[model samples]
Target: MPDDDATPRAPRPALADAVHEIERHVAGGGWDGPVRVFALVRTAAALDADPGLADRLPAEAVAAARADAAHLTSVEQEGLPQASSLEDLLARLSWPQTVDGVALVVERVVLPSAAEAAMPADPEEALAYLMAHPDRQDVRIAVGVLRDGGSWCAVRARANDDDAAVAGGADLVPGLVAALATTLE
Candidate 1:
């Protein structure tokens, strides 16, 4: 006997898959340097692909995705920001809900002695020098975030022993994380 009154089930939320990908990425010390990662998703596509998410998603967000399909991009193909530029990069980006989530794997810059010597005392000049000398840097802290407002961070300091400290070290980039979170909002 067929159950005509029953509604069909929605697909799994696409966010689950994306979060899983993040988990896998960080599982094996894979993240080594500063990288700004974003998951630019089309709300329509996400819903079509994972209808289960509709129950939790707001109408406005879905509308925004439909309206801005042109701006949507796949993270798989586009890849993360591959440089160590720690400038106010987030200031330049303000994505709508249709754009999905963004994650950042950032590292505190440690300059080589020679490069540090060459850098000017002026902050502006130092920024310019660092921008031109990407080769002379090493990154240590890595943070990841999801559109649903979940966040994670990892650290690889020169001599880190306390797990609590490493976990708590996420506080080091609250401003950046806050900025990235707005993209999902």
Candidate 2:
């Protein structure tokens, strides 16, 4: 796989253009379906990639992004690949740069947060995805009320069981619990 950083990230779009696109998407908001989160965030990231586009996004986009994460997941699974290169798509959505840490956080943390309205689901498998991936982050901050003693957790390589990555649980489950509490609270 190519280095995400080295990849020509979708042409460093001009800021004004980025903002305009974001605003445009915001105006057409209320796309409340699976993958909505991804769409909503894409707007901001596009702007981040080009700050000039900030004025483009409407206020409603934030609300949509906050409320509809399941849709974001769907969008990532179904839409991103069709639109651009995975790196470009990921950049467009402001996905965490570290694939491994990102995978783990999304699976172990973000997924559970999304399910807050319904049954509490387990994100262990999701974490496993990150653990299995090669490009994992060495340290991740788990802040707020859920933080493990109000601290960040370091996810380093432990020489044991390279294959079995804290299955059914987070590598730093204790910190995860703390982080979740903060996020939920």
Candidate 3:
């Protein structure tokens, strides 16, 4: 059997665009924010279900949906219950059939691999250590996964905080991508 991790999945343009869109939207709010989740839905399907929605959605988005059947719209989820960790939040998530996919935006302070050995065991101390580390990097990661197994990720570093500087790929953040994929399952 082929190793799933080794398999390369073709990039889904619509999903990539949706992930990037969510990343940019979250970036607009600046850093030091709570985790945000979004439900991905096919714009055409959403419109067909309720044509009245067009009046509420952005005009450009609606027009794009009409022009391309693959266009996806990201609907931000609100009032999510607080979880001890992101993994716990993801573990508790399950999507409805209507949701084509899911995306999550989260900001994290990352240090170089060398810093891992020096991290404090206490959660609070670890956070403090990370914050005080001279090499620490603040990054916002947006990961999107479709039910069809397509996934995309967008990463924006605080050091190079520019929309055009954002890095994107299918496996940029593989662990997060897999976690998001399980929500669809």
Candidate 4:
């Protein structure tokens, strides 16, 4: 029912609901949701590192988690984020950090109530939004994480941007994690 090109999206605020739903899906226990959840939590951490990101949204960790769900969609398993706009965040990210401003973006939104919430609203628009964020030097942290995770499209966008600052900065970040992505992903 989902597609690879489908944009990654933001998650919502249904922690309890999500937990319950996941519990049912894997009533037997020892499910592998952590890998996906950790990835998003990391993304939120990165957003919190940015100074300007917080004023735009609070509770970034939640947002980051949802973004993670959207991204996990690529795997084509059960449960993910529902929002479409969040793809902008997902299509562009790789990690979230607990240090610095990354927390702001991480904690902004709420998660979904069930596995169905993973459904996206508008994949194309979300993808474009994610692509657009790294167009400048200001979103370096965001770009860095996304590029590191496996989002080559974000890396290419930054590498090819008109702004030398963004292009140059993006160039350096990916290499830092180049070796890591291969073994990590």
| Candidate 2 weakest ten by summed lDDT | 140-149
TM-score of every model? 0.41, 0.18, 0.92, 0.19
Give the Å shift of residue 85 in candidate 1. Answer: 4.6
Which residue ranges in model 4 land beyond 4 Å of their true spot?
1-58, 67-174, 182-185
lDDT of 3 at 121: 100
lDDT of 1 by residue, 130-154 (tens): 8788655444555444454544445
Candidate 4 per-residue lDDT over residues 2-80, each given as its tens digit: 1144342222222222322222333223222221221222334444456464455446534644466422111112243
Off by over 4 Å in 1: 1-34, 40-85, 96-100, 110-121, 124-139, 146-150, 158-172
Top candidate, metric TM-score: 3
lDDT of 2 by residue, 107-161 (tens): 1212233333343246685556545554443322111111112212222122222
Model 3 alpha-carbon drift over 4 Å, by segment:
1-8, 121-124
The model with the greatest lDDT is: 3
lDDT of 1 at 175: 60
Cα RMSDs, all models: 14.0, 18.0, 2.3, 20.6
Candidate 1 lDDT: 0.51
TM-score, cand. 3: 0.92
Clashes of each: 0, 22, 0, 44
**Candidate 3 lDDT over residue span 19-109, tens digit each:** 9999998999989999999999999999999999999999999999999888999999998877999999998999899999999999988
lDDT of 3: 0.91
- Extract clashing residue pairs from model 3: none
